[model samples]
Target: MKVIIAVLSAVLLHCTQAMAAAQTGFFIDAPITGIQYVTSSGIEGQTDQGAYQFSDGDVVDFYLGEGPSAFHLASVSAEKWVSPNSMTVTHTRTINMTRLLLAMSDFNKSDNILTVNQAKISQPAVQDFLGELNLIELDTLAQRYDIEIPSVGEAAAHLQSSYQYIKQSLSSDEIVYAPRDTELRDILIKTRNYQGHLCFYNVDEIDNPSYVGPVGSTTYKITNKGIFEYPDNGDRYGSNDGVIASCDVDLRAKRTEEEFHEVSSFEGWSGLFACALKGCTRTNLSGYVVEEYDSGNSYKYRANAMTFNPSTQIVLNKKQGLGQHEKVDGPNNAEFIWFTFASRDVTPLSFEGQWQEKQINKEGVSYRCLDIKQGQVWATPFSDSHCRARNSAGFKNASVEFGDMWWLQSSAKDLYFYHLNIPVAWKDSNQTQHYTTWEYLPVSDSLNNGILYRYQQILDEKDQSLRTSQVSELTKL
Candidate 1:
């Protein structure tokens, strides 16, 4: 009986020795699997503009097994749980992979103790992905634009693949630590290729305790398929400003540098011409011609571009002007006619295809031309009978000046008139009579010579004779 008891004691001692050895293999305080814990208030579906928020001071649970035992929101301290944002835990508590196991082995629940067979845990995939993500800088602009970045709660979501990868590449010498910034979470997420480059917007780093929000914003692409372009505001609209600015990405690249291929670019005045006359019957017609816009008051400004020309079938002279055999000027101020028409010898101006016309008024016409797009003006002429009327039937080129606005006349002269001032108002030009884009040009003062009946040589969509107005305003005189 004594021999049997001795044998049992030896066996028990051997088991005890084995257990101690196993315990020694694991670091007493090795980091547990879970370091992230969402606050109690972070139940689900709480967001501002589809963004989730995280608060500090939440008690996180680190478990021994990756399968059933991992870190989670086991509980929270009463003092720390009062307010979600109030959970400010001291940074003094540092938990890592090496020390987590040693710190919790004495717990009654074995599952609560973090453990691994080896002293070091390796995960290359997680590390590789995290490493790649670390190179990416997270800015407020990136967040607003929806670029992927890391967050505190994202590691567990990708634990299986990420953990195994990091484990394979991990070594005792080098350890992967928890990212201080949550943006690393975004880098781990696999996403589609982005086509647009980044353009930094604003920066406001002073608003938060971490001084993070002030990093500003940058515009970048979400997809890499080389799809449509993204405007400055990140949205496409139908306004003149939107359409005019939405030039082809490739075309912009060719004109600018190769780097701008990924940035937004526009042709400016050329783009406006395209928007105004694209799909017209005379799309083939090209050459610099005169285009005018009204100033906020009573003046007008005209610009000359090579793309401006009459796209109509009407017989016109080589030069576009009042009477036959007269020289017409380019849209620029250098070519603008400043005649007040106070004398009978008012010169007849020649137009494309041998057409000719001239102003007949003798009361001294006066007007000024402004270039709103360029924010400048032509020779500010203040004279009498300054308005000029086109004898042609083309309505698109005709313009009528009202109290304080200029309306764009369409081919049909019956569509919604576009407001020149605000650019977005496609409503009726005259409040008394609701007009369409192609409706009759409304006149304000008949004696005041508010409307200048002129016609552009632009053609219609069906290859029909189309004439549109460039601009109209009150007689500057």
Candidate 2:
């Protein structure tokens, strides 16, 4: 009897030891398999565009189980869209071992469903997508009068491919810490911000330049009025200063030494001339951006290459010192004429041929000319009418002794947008040594003439002030 009892004790002890040595693996109920446990907010019917995919906006559970278990369980949580602007846990806290073990056990679950209670998932996740109607919009303005609007692919293709173009810009390092989530969150917010206008309109193609007969070969003009931030605030449609922008796009333009390949590169434009004022280099240009933004919206272009003009080199530092109110440029003392345009995507669904034509004074504007892809906007008269219209200011601010103006110089009018800008540094006519990619343009009233007529404000509380005010106003008359 004594031997049997001793044997039973030894067997029980051995079983206990075996269990202790083995790493505890768990089976998660469907939802927690991926970081975005809830793919839809209850309001979604199926991709209503109002639906929510809580990948970035969701607060998810983080377990440090990539390697050996520390036996010490830590509870880390974060809000993807919050200010300190990171998904990392601000502080660490301890939780009951029982709850953590349950969460950790589900880590290895094959089922990818969010059956778990929404409350249990995390804190500050998106509860509803349509709940806040801060939707994105695309607008187009024909830059050239006789622009040969190119044939375009489907919206699904551009949108899908755009997703890839932006994804490629995010380096592996930006997401190494939390590999699964927050990788593309930066661009997502940027896209949200740029599209957050208060009131926008559907551009109508006009036959005649409202002011005169024929201005130039390129007669297309951009008329934008009141770009709103949210649907709710769009009610006050009459409050925005509209603009009429005319330009002629040259398809042959090329960009050089410009590395906006990443969204974060845009963020580096933190302070005033951080690069130009201090002198920038290819090596340090990457450091100039403070954060990566959704520059993709600016890239809704017709041409594959995003450039101001041929051979233009975007100086990383010239875009510095811009504030939320940077659009308000005082009387030009500066000749560099650094300007950025708030463009709405105007690409057409299909093209009959290169030259887009419409009856004069059409009710709606159709984007039929050179499709604007992305980047800051600069104007060089494409036609005699356009040239004369803008010439009201004076003679050429400067001369373009060099650049890819061969076609324009040789073309009929013997002219092209003389000023170079976008994808890099641009200069006004006064610049003699502007090609160094460090020169600033002369600050003229006309420099920002195109971007002068717009105001955007937010109406939704959720989208109003995540980390900063969701309001933006720009007047460059």
Candidate 3:
């Protein structure tokens, strides 16, 4: 009797678990509406309130229309909230699904409640257009329909396509076929409006907020208009003619809370070179060095010194002499912190002009001028009071011109600046030939108390180790 009771209890637990897994869930990435979904367990229906019912361990496939003319969108795992990010299908399918939703949203421009028309999508021409459609062609269709689609690329007025009419129809669906649920509609609208930049790093975290990590990290720029550009060399310095893609990207506020915390200034250093006239002293630095920038005219930062000694070995060689130290102070240090606050009215084109360095005196504090001209960033010394007048006259012979710099404005009107291809020389274990490599500086903006905080990555040349460290603070002037 005892054995039979134990077996029955185990069976009941299994059934309960199975039933919980098969519960109803919603599809989101902003709660897509009026789409058909089929589960692996053969459960099929149109998503009501973005809802779907499925058995445990079921794979859900989404579609547009029914039968022969149906367009198979994405196949993803049956979960509480299925989204493009949750898709189990290939990346191509995920991208296409996202594009389709974006196109639908663009068509229904009055609100964020994305409702698709089955009659329009089921048409033969529309199916053909969707089959051959690439992301770059969305804008052309938007214009033909006299509708605006928020994208990251420039509008090509003369872009010709054979399926132009089909695209236009898809962009401007005439009949509202689906039932409107005001309560459900509001939920979708709220989710869509709250969407921020789809970054590689979680923007919610204060530490490692942006893509400030290892060398192999994905480095791409998405403009306010929705144009996505991925540089071949990983840094967007020289030219953006490499590869262009489009997505639902926006430059929104990364962090919502208003708080400030200081991180280690020397978070990525393996060792420090304490050099003198006669000889150089090498001291292995461990852990992190936090610096407070409450008030200071000059700020000091670290860079990767070009050397063959591995970071692991350098840490082991604590307080040891490493011959005569070369006067190798690279262009990694900036004399003054420059702040650029972009108003909501500023467009990408208007923000791309040459910026001259101006001496700003705020709260009785004088700062050096840092200006940009034709992608080159010129940093002037604070000692030179006449830097502003000279900068107006084309100060080509400035103190330092960090090559090929760029800036992007976020949706919250915060501006981010970057310096690319800064050279760092290093050697291998075999001590073969001295090779110079480039490093990228992605400026962080953690704003608090009228001051914009910036963090920079310090690289260890020997082993290519990288860590994000707080470098500078910019106060609004």
Index of the highest-TM-score prediction:
3
Could you tell which candidate, 1 or 2, scores higher by TM-score?
A: 2
Error of 2 at 22 (Å): 31
Quote the positional error of residue 106 for candidate 3 in Å.
8.9
Error of 3 at 362 (Å): 62
- Expressed as tens digits, the lDDT of each residue in 68-139 for candidate 2 is 111212111112111100111100000112122233223322422222233433322111111111111101
Per-residue lDDT over 251-310 for candidate 3, one digit per residue giving the tens place of the 0 to 100 score? 221223323232233233222211111112111111111122223543333211111111
lDDT of 1: 0.22
Task: Supply the global lDDT for candidate 3.
Answer: 0.33
Prediction-by-prediction clash tally: 103, 58, 6
- Write the residue-wise lDDT of candidate 1 on 139-194 in tens digits: 22224334333331222122222223223322233211211111110001001002
Please give the lDDT score at residue 125 for candidate 1: 28
TM-scores for every predicted model:
0.14, 0.17, 0.28
Q: Which 10 consecutive residues of model 1 have the lowest summed lDDT?
A: 184-193
